[model samples]
Target: MSKKFTIPSHSEIQNAKSNRNNPTPAIFQKRKQSEQPNESIIEENVPKQSSEKVMNKTSTFRSFQSDSKPTVPTVTPVSANSSQSPEKAVDKSGTYRSFETVNRPQKPLVSTTTPLLVNSKQRGNPILKHIHNVAWEYSDIVPDYILGQTTCALFLSLRYHQLHPGYIHERLKLLGRTFELRVLLAQVDIKDSSHICQQLANICLLADCTLILAFTPEEAGRYLELYKAFENKPPDLIMEKSEESFEAKLIDTLTSVKKINKTDAITLYSTFGSVKNIFTATEEDLSLCSGIGPLKAKRLHKAFNEPFIKNIKKKAIEEVNSTEVKEKCEKGIGNENDNENEGC
Candidate 1:
């Protein structure tokens, strides 16, 4: 069947066009209120669907998180009666360990052999080896007594080139019986060769030791001749008793009396010519001598000029007694002569 087409009237179309173009105020207000209600409905419906989608997404996230979590390992406590050591268990665990289970260094084992046994063959002599070892291993190889003796001898030798026998004997007494003469002499430092010869001569005179000098055959005969001449030489008694000359004797006398040395004595003797002259000379005269200072001159002058009171008193008494005795003898002789004449 063919549907009949209907067309709007002209008046109705014109009225619809007028309503769209210019609507009343009340109609516009009604349309806006209607649009507001529809928009509120759309907003409410959109929020409900969005909230449901968010809830579904959160549930899916929670399931994924549960599946991805790692499992915690379980640990079984080791029994005390276990065959393995605690260190072995700790090593197997490979995570945590105690300080007691850590590896420690071990000490090496040492043999019980003596040092002498080990080194004697290489050193050739056990005694020498022991001495070397002791000397090398220790700082104090010298004994306290030896050091003390050396120190004392050094001080004494520095002061006096020749040590007295009495003083040495006293020191020996203090050192007891174990003191060594060689060691003491080795420690003494005599600076001069002449002093050493003098010391050797003095030692020969004082001690019982004999010194021998060995020489090559080429020089032996010459030395032998010298030795013979020395042996045949006369004793030095005269030289010891008297000096080489009167000046030397005068120097020695001045040294003895005035406590001056040979140099000063020589200077004084050369200036004064004689001991009597030196005694009579004034302090000014002594000071004028070479090498004689004012203090030494004054000392010499005072010693020589001071009179001997005891001797003077003794001489005066003897003279007085002699005069009185002579007078008495003369008077007795006169009386005796007179008596003898009367008797005649």
Candidate 2:
């Protein structure tokens, strides 16, 4: 069963190659037709189906994404309003007006039931008799009198001050500067009162106090009574008034004396040309006026050029000032340049 090994001729091989190129060979042509259908089938039908599904899915996704994307907004312009209330509405425009105010602080209330509070030690003093104009209460106080919340007074009689000159210094040192207003009410009682008053003035000046000199105890008591009565009143109540009209001024000036009235004041102005003429007029000339009587004329004439405080012999104060006193020459030193204690 062995076969012989033989090589094909070249002409036979050529003829078979020529057959592969020529589709007229029945078997080869049939094979090529079957193979071409399989390869071309995938290329035409499968690619079309697969590519159409993928294209549809991608196109749908792109459409959905484009629809879901946010669009650009349109901007609108707003105009400013002329008036707006801050209590209700807000101002969003360019212009805004605002105001701020503060509540006025309530004034601090000052409460004082009694007008004056006197020291219990001052119960026997005569100043209490003249204090009838205002109510007063007695309390154990450091100062002799207390007029108001911030005012206090220290009483010193010149008669007593002469007996103990060092007493006031101790009292003042103790009093210090506790009160806003301190008053040193001095009643002049001695012939050497001038010297003592100077010393008191110096002491009061150094101690930050106002010194009031009273010649009589009655005057001093009147001052104390008035101090309490007018504590709350303004200074203009007792100060000299400046009237707007000349008639008002003349009437005020003419009615200043006791027992003179407005009727008499007007009558005198009508009778006399001016105040100069009135001042030059005598009692007889003044009495000739319509309403003024003899007593009033004489009183008015006396009031014209009279001294309020007169006939008091006030001698010059003695050289008791520490600034003016000569230093002591103890040990009798002879050098001119040295102090008196060390020099002659």
Candidate 3:
């Protein structure tokens, strides 16, 4: 069988071809002359009157701005040689003022004189002078507060002793007395109680008085008991001396001669059997003792080796002999001068 085909009309064929070649308005314009040439045509067609109006508006705005705007005052730089304080610097024209100079006041100069620390009365007191010297010597070990408390305690204790002649013996009699004094003072709320106790202990030690083993409150009651037990006992006689242990005597001797602390004394005694052994011990041996470094050992050795009493006696005898010989020589020279005068 033969099939018949439907033919497109001329108009339909032309429309379809046009749509395929230029589907959108942009593509159709692109096929013509460039779009830049059209832009010039548009700008030429625009009215000159609109441009003139815009220029006139801009000119009016500029004039309004010039009239309404504020004027800024000119600022001159300040000079180094200006006749004004550093706080009050003057500008080159001398018109502008500094806020600091106007608002702030000048500070006064400070005094240079050193204020006196000790009063005249303290200086006069030998005890106070001694304490001050001790505090200075041991400044590294003792603090200012401790030193102050010690001074106050010593003053009060000495004052009390003076007021009560027989009550406070010439020497501190018992170690328990330190605790008793502390307990008596505790109710008064003394400042730095521990330091005060330590100072009192040191004073008692210097006076050759017995001292408490510890400064704790717990030991205070024990001290009271000891005081009661020893209260009835008669005072120790000078002639009838109590037998002190060898170690105690050794420690006392070491402390007195070497000026060492109790710990160092004990260490020395422990290392060497007796005081004689300690004195005889070389610096190396002394250094081997615990807590005694080479420096302290050298000092200990020097103190022991020093001929203190022997040197003093020898010096005294030499001085006397020299004086006698000088007197005899002077007499002899006077006799010779007389003989010469007689001959003349």
Candidate 4:
């Protein structure tokens, strides 16, 4: 078996050799270049030298950051000697009761040694006695209505009529008719006090008898002291014949006159020392007494100045002497007639 072989044309064989030796046309070559990467293309795909250098520095920083980071220190746990169960904690059941504090009853702080208020019978202070005595003259003499009118007048007059202690005592002594004074006081009590002065005027009654009395501050004090001593004690005018008796009499006289609606009378009694003194008192002097109004004082002055018994006595004495002389002359004539008849 002999095989027949077809031979390639010389042009064809030369074209094959030329195609292998020479590059293709520009268009075909460009297509082939595009399809495959050259050295420049490969370099463009890779970073430039500066960028590669920066990448190297970033890698160094990452490594340094990883190495420089701080680490937490590890702590080892301690072991117990034995794993014994914990002992049960004991709790106390004892009660802590607060003590009951009782408050004691407080006692009143009174002193046992203090003295009682029992009155003593000793002499009282003399100055107090004097002041009380003086105040009584104002009270006994001055009425509430006329106090303002006669204040200065009474004050000056009373001040002027300053009695010595001895004189005060003597004046009180003379007015010490205690029984008669008490009777007068009791009668005045029975009478209607409002009509006492009026009734006396209507009846034309004279004061049955005049009580001579005097007032002074010392007398008031003495009476106060007497009352203090004898008050609540038994009455015995004779047995209690002390200074108190005299003081009682003085009080009686004063109280009687006061009760008779005659404060003016009492005031006059105080100033003049007796009814006689008031009877003789001038209008000006009586006017100075407290409660004596101008008209009443003037009336009293006129009444006193007009002598009652004094004038009557003078006239009676003159009549009696004249009658005695006339009787003697008639007796002598009758004697001559009897002689002539006997001779005939």
Candidate 5:
């Protein structure tokens, strides 16, 4: 038997090739379009060196860039009136601003010891002549004289206080809490000195300042000198003679009598050597003491021996003696009217 042969059209041929996994013309065109990068895609590869490129731009690295390009951040231009503010200079220097550590300058150390401070105004003061024992120099200080680190001195003349009574008060207020031991040296220059001195003493007491009364400027200077000289010494140096001595006690004892003054008592003690001997001495011996006059001596002698009787008994005895004397006179006269007094 003879078989009949048939020819397929081009469209049928393409459909058969496609079913067999053979690449068709449309599929090949799509593959070529994918392999050949788009011009827009290729132009997107702008880099740091567009003019001086290191590699060929037709590199295989640019093949899938259009499909797999990373989402690049869009940059917006800032306007002049934008709310954004420039960084502050302090923010950079302060903490948490930068990774680098911020180092601050350190403070200098203060000393525990300080030099003696004297007011510059006291340069020509005569009291400065006495401040030689301690090392001192001039300074623009507050107090009139800074004796020690915690001690100071303020001078006030009684005359000046009389003129400007509140001057010392102003000065005391100026001291404030600076000095622990404040001294006010007062020179008694006025005639009515005791009353003003007492007022100053009270002022010093309330102001916590020690008051030193001076009659002369030199004496005041000497006090300032002693304070500096004994600044570091123990307080017991002045506490030695706190109690009265034997001579002072004896003098006070002998002066207890109303008539016996201090000089008279001393004279009597020197003459008799003891209290018993002084009382036992005769009136003539008491008179022989230098200050005891004859009247004082006789009165002192009588005081020791006199009886302690009431004035009524002594007056009654004197009245009886006067009556007896009157009766004797009447008897001697022998008068009639005096007969009533005969019984007397």
Candidate 6:
């Protein structure tokens, strides 16, 4: 008593298809393929290697449908056996592309042999450029390491608002520690720089700077003489004393040797210390000290060498008389002078 479903005949199905465009399985598949064309379009637009070959193919198979100038179009994919030729499709898709916009980088104008500053464009600090150049120029005289240390010390002092004293002292101390005596001594000879000498002298007094003193035997000997002279004299010589000072002795020495007046001589001595030091000092350096002029310096130089010069008039009085005879003669002369004064 079960009823069975009957299958429709082919004529009935054909009549229904003619009546409506209903999408069966095959039509539905075609519709789906048409909806998604992005991948196919991208693949079709990909250019073949050579544009010339594609252009030739386009000309051969293509017909001018319009009398107007034909513009080349981008290519789309076509089946090999389809009515669309590969050349026409490749040309139409613009896949025979030879056009490219590449960026070409510029070359630097550096040569292998160019100098450091010029080639590297390392202008350095404008203010320090001269100093840097000078350092390199005399690298043989002053090593890079020492120059760097000195410059750094100077910069630090400036930044800290320090005077030249601490900077100079520390640097000289470092030099001593490093045992750069020869260089230090050479620097002591700098006529244009007495700060270096003054610092060295202070170091010697402090007993902290030993390298320079040890390196040069001659300078050491001179320094020894100076020390001995200091020790034998009163502290007043170097310090303030009511009776006498180092300044006074120095003035006396200069006055004795130079035959200058007490005031001018004291001024010169106070300014330059000793006869020898004054004589040896350059005019410019002496002028900076105080109360020194070209004339004074010249006169001092002459006075310093006077001891060796012949003074005939003063030599006769220096002859030694026998002690007994000299006393009797002095007595006789005094009595005669007294009688003559009494008569007047």
Give the residue spans of candidate 1 off by over 4 A: 1-241, 272-279, 290-295, 302-310, 321-344
> What is the C-alpha local distance difference test score of each model?
0.50, 0.76, 0.52, 0.43, 0.71, 0.45
Residue-pair clashes per candidate: 0, 2, 1, 2, 0, 12
Question: Candidate 3 or 5, higher TM-score?
Answer: 5
Candidate 5 clashes between residue pairs 3 or more apart in a chain or in different chains = none
**Tens digit of lDDT per residue, candidate 6, span 136-185?**
22222221122222111111112221235465456444444433221222
Model 1 compared with the native: what TM-score? 0.23
Per-residue CA lDDT of model 3 for 1-344, tens digit only, reads: 89998999999999999989977787767777563445456446544455446447555322321336555555444555766654454454556566455459767697432221233332343333323212122222211111221121112232343445444333234223332232221111243456655655666556544344333333433433343334335567325674488877777777875548889998888778777798899999998877888988888998989877768878999899778667666666557775455342
Local error of candidate 1 at residue 203 (angstroms): 35
Worst 10 residues of 6 by lDDT: 148-157
Best by lDDT: 2
lDDT accuracy of residue 185 in candidate 6:
24
Q: Order the candidates by TM-score, highest first — what do you get? A: 2, 5, 3, 1, 4, 6
Best by TM-score: 2
The better-scoring model by TM-score among 1 and 4 is 1
Cα error of candidate 4 at position 100, Å: 71
Best-to-worst ranking by lDDT = 2, 5, 3, 1, 6, 4
| Tens digit of per-residue lDDT, candidate 2, span 226-298 | 7777777889876976779999999999899889999999999889979998877999999999879999999
Q: How does candidate 5 fare on TM-score?
A: 0.37
- Could you tell me how far off, in angstroms, the CA of residue 82 lies in candidate 5 after the best superposition? 62
For model 4, how does the per-residue alpha-carbon lDDT over 1-344 read when each residue is reduced to its tens digit?
99999999999999999889996788997898787756556446555455446448555322321336555443222235544322321123332322122234667797332211112221252323453311222232211111122111101112222323233224334434322211111012232344443443332223232221114445433534443344335667647454456434544444443222346666777788866676677778877977876777777666556665657878999899778657666666557675455342
Model 4 clashing residue pairs (backbone): 133-217, 134-217
Question: What TM-scores do the predictions have?
Answer: 0.23, 0.38, 0.26, 0.19, 0.37, 0.19
lDDT of 2 at 142: 88
- Candidate 5 local lDDT, residue 3: 96
* Per-residue lDDT of model 5, residues 1-344, tens digit only: 99988898999998998878965579888898888866666556555454324246545444333356555444333345765433222332242231123345556686444455678876786666765655677888778777786789887777777778888888788778788998888777778787887888888788878988888767877777777767788888667664367667767766665587778877877888887897788899999878789987987787655666757778999899889868677667666566456543
